[model samples]
Target: MSEKLTLHKYQSDITGLMIEHKAFGVFAEPGTGKTPTSLYVVNHFRQKTLVIAPIRIAYSVWPPETKKWSDFNNIKTGLLHGLDKEQRFLDDSIGIYIINPEGLVWLESMVAKHKRFPFTNLIVDESAKFKSPSSKRFKALKRVIGLFKRRYILAGNPMPNSYMDLWAQIFLLDRGERLGRTISAYRNRFFTRGGFRGYEYFLRPGAEEEIKDLIKDICIFIKATDHLDLPKLVINDIRFDLPKGLRKKYRVMEKQLFWDLDEGKILASSAAVANSKCQQIAQGFLFESLSDKQKYDKVTKKVYDLHNIKIELLEELVDELNGSPLLVGYWFRPDYDKLKKAFPKAVYFADSSKSEAVQIEKDWNAGKIPLLIGNIASISHGLNLQKAGNHVCFYTMVWNYDMYDQFIKRVLRQGNDNDRVFVHRIIANKTMEEAMIMSMQDKSAMSSGFLNAINLYREKIKEYDE
Candidate 1:
């Protein structure tokens, strides 16, 4: 038989990661081979690897990739997704388990039924899901972390908001040693101002320096732009002029809201004031105050209308692209409506009522539908759509780095034979869209060591001065 399928670069990185027992974060971007790098680390340490990820991703990453890599086609791997089966040997040689975070909701009873072996290593892929301290998934992962001797938190973009790392992620890394034992302690030591209720610590500017120093011996940071053989990525920002009507409405509401506030004519709590600002952004109209029920009712209607606008834009863009199969990335519910209306025949994860999702995949590869749209969180991981479409378009920009990377790789993977893949970003001018683009560029560079890409971004920024 031929030499075992091996990517030496990935193997080298795995060695480094396995040697480090402290909490490690893999900042590798989409298509930079994080899965292989992680797998090799598991193989090197000869430890049981437990992967907690989204359901779709769990199916896409392990069995298929493992078959491609190892000579043993029936290597042992357990999927703890749906029904509980009696404890089974992964393979006589190795044990690998993959479970969706949703499964963790019933994990206590499940573990009781089938005694869980102490997990040697735990890999939390797409770790941004745990950023919210109050979320059930975050708490579930926290409980599961205790069973692992070593842990790895894999994310392309771990730090989005300032408060993210303090509670959820820091707890995973070292359980309060580097950051704090609790969110309150973390805030006390590293944060001081701009938090909720006017006294919380929100942003920690020196956190990066502190993190690197503390994990100096434990963590490894790798950027994709540092790799020589990786294909060059060219990111272009396609901005659309904002509708003049929207701008005028925005200004009229802004002036009226402040005028009312300045004259002491409006009396409301801080939450009411914040809600007014949110209304302006959400619907291009401002309300002095809205009860939670009113806000919820209004938000639902506005989102429905927003979905119409997205479909309109997508139809126009699809026409512009000459009907080439387009891969559309969405984030919100509004996106789903627009996508469904525009491509009635579209195969979507949410449309499970029509046909089974796995069967739909076969239809997709067979070229049944030309246009596909879904949230990046849903479509980005584990799926290969290289045969379906090469043109990727973002219905809206996303903040999470891993989702962005995985979204692009779904079409541009290694076995893909297509030429000249085009990525189109549909952004509304002078909105959060501008900020999202800048943030993604900065974070992508940080993850992938694309020195030239960084230089190009700086040059483009300098153009504004000239």
Candidate 2:
């Protein structure tokens, strides 16, 4: 049996705030015990709760979390997913029903057919998924949200893309009380149309402060660094030059959007296409065909091998680790293919079945796997890999700052036993990879609005105490 779980001071404080407000946003960083904290709120309310989360998290994280903590023994949780989901819903002994965002459509139909909504409390985990007001799932939830007496939305970085992503998420919490009744109203009040063909919206001066103030009363934002003594994060950008011949081909592709290979001539029809091809080439391979219809499968496509500069460096880095478990992050199909070839013992996180994925996570945490590989998008959220090791290598850098940050936190989080976590980025010098890394940095800087709100709330609390 697991030991009794103890809440951190911040977790207890956040729980108090959530219970008081009833409708709230818990924008706490990953691995700071957000799941258990939310579970505490569920236990306190003793109401039937509906949790909408990412598919993997809906199935794997919540149900198991109840069993992991002794305090949660009274909270009976059921996963409303897969073919057995309908049957699971029939079991009324369950106090919490967990489903994915897309499942909301089916759930709405079920509620309509039954002429009743079973749940009185709603929790949307990774609530950023509902950022689009036009999304089918969001629309379905919006229709039925009035039935829930209490609501909560949870995310580490709620606004992953832009401030435009905030309206729908906040609307779910306050039903447009804080932002506006409609997205158009919110946009017209605080933003101006800009960018290509005026498709993008830029915030007006002081709009950010106004928006944050409107939502500050009901939102609780916590950073792990402020509350938890996690391991030191050391990021190293390992730079290298491509071979002379490969370098010439890369430049030709970047300049002309076309390159000649022995297998065939690779043509990039646009700058976006050329940029994508350049990234692949920098990672040591180039796909001969750029057809979107073609899917990556067991059979290898006609890919031309460019150079193994990153792979060779990875081998040296592994040797330097002297057998410590290494988690490698890959972006493209070719990157995974090359890494698996170079390290035959490496386990791919996404290639396994659901049952197999569970065992893989077990073996990984037990230090049974030396080199574990995964795409940033697959292993970025709600999956815990902190017990395995402290070293992470990015064979190719991801352009999205959220994915990159979440993947690194998989090891750098609260449970990590290491004194320092080392993140290695293998960059092909003077290539688009460098540009991507810088772009991610800029995006990271833009995501500080949530942290700013946290600071503002803390100051208000201090003033009240005085």
lDDT of each: 0.60, 0.81
**Which candidate has the top score in lDDT?**
2
Model 2 TM-score on a 0 to 1 scale: 0.88
Best by TM-score: 2
Query: Candidate 2: deviation at residue 169, Å?
Result: 0.4
Predicted candidate 1 versus true structure: per-residue lDDT over 1-466, tens digit per residue:
3226656575476557656665677755555667767777776676777788767667666655676576434446777765443343223344677777776666656566656564678888867668887788888777767778888877655654444453577578787777677877766766546423354343366865765676555555565546524334445456554456665554455456445534545432222333244233432222243345754754223321421344556678788877577888876565565567668876576665312544555556666657777778777766667666568888766655556877887776654556556788876554444544665766542212222332343445443321
- Superposed model 1: Cα runs more than 4 Å off: 1-3, 19-23, 45-47, 71-74, 84-94, 113-118, 133-146, 228-231, 234-247, 253-313, 352-369, 386-388, 398-406, 412-421, 429-466
- For model 2, residues 161-273, the per-residue Cα lDDT tens digits are 67888999999998998889999999999999754346557789999899999999989788899999999988898999888877777776654432231112431112223
TM-score of 1: 0.73
TM-score of each: 0.73, 0.88
